[model samples]
Target: MRTGGGSMTTPVHNSPRTLVLSTKTWERELAAELVRLGHSPAKSRYVANKLLKRIVGRAGWQRQAFLVD
Candidate 1:
């Protein structure tokens, strides 16, 4: 990753769960949720997409807690 003036460009990660939200409400809501979850704003899309994928992806993987209680 390269950084200039304290901001770094994030590279796209390879994820099996990749979702592209089209509805404005969905996009906005997901971005807000991701931010609330502490992800950087710049990475909101990637994080949100990955999350959507997991939600709608083929069912075969074990579930992990996103937040520890």
Candidate 2:
């Protein structure tokens, strides 16, 4: 995992209220990213969870991680 210090890119179309509401991050940096991506914090959170679960679930070992030996 990144140490919350790496650089990320977001579109320049989103607003601060959106960033805060969607991303739910008190961190100014993260909120900035949410704006850059043109996503409300809520949109960011929703998209992140949706895509992440698919990626994680695609790994064969991921199922094992959710199950007992």
Candidate 3:
């Protein structure tokens, strides 16, 4: 893991359920809500795709992808 300048990057999945799934049964509904509020769902694979980043790719910069206002 990198700290104070290093090559290795810190592991991200340090905890389980750090980002939980959406309670809405319909994924489309949740996505619509996010879009209506002028925000975007990070991705559309899992119940909540906000925590996703491509393998070997940098983690997304936005922390609150699901948040509105």
Candidate 4:
């Protein structure tokens, strides 16, 4: 998705409070969790992406809050 004229793949500046992981890492961890719970690999990836989207959205909210403070 686009953000401030940049795509989501754009590298963001790192902050102590904003230690963001790579999307692939997030997806891998999420998928592993799902697999442990008996989900198929393909389904796990699909669900992981869905969950990661919401997580990234909330991360933006947190970043806004950080700026406000």
Whose TM-score is greatest here?
4
**What's the TM-score of every candidate structure?**
0.41, 0.36, 0.25, 0.52
Supply the global lDDT for candidate 3.
0.36
lDDT of 3 by residue, 7-34 (tens): 2223336543233222232244545566
State each model's CA lDDT, in order: 0.50, 0.40, 0.36, 0.58
Q: On residues 1-69, what C-alpha lDDT tens digit does candidate 4 reach at each position?
A: 112232323333654334334466557677889998999987999998888778768776432211200
Model 3, which residues run further than 4 Å from truth?
Answer: 1-25, 41-69
Question: Which candidate leads in lDDT?
Answer: 4
For every candidate in turn, the CA RMSD to the true structure comes to: 13.1, 14.7, 14.2, 8.6
Q: Model 4: how far is 59 from its true place, Å?
A: 4.1
Q: Worst 10-residue stretch by lDDT in candidate 2?
A: 17-26
Pairs clashing within candidate 2: 10-36, 10-37, 11-36, 11-37, 22-41, 22-42, 23-41
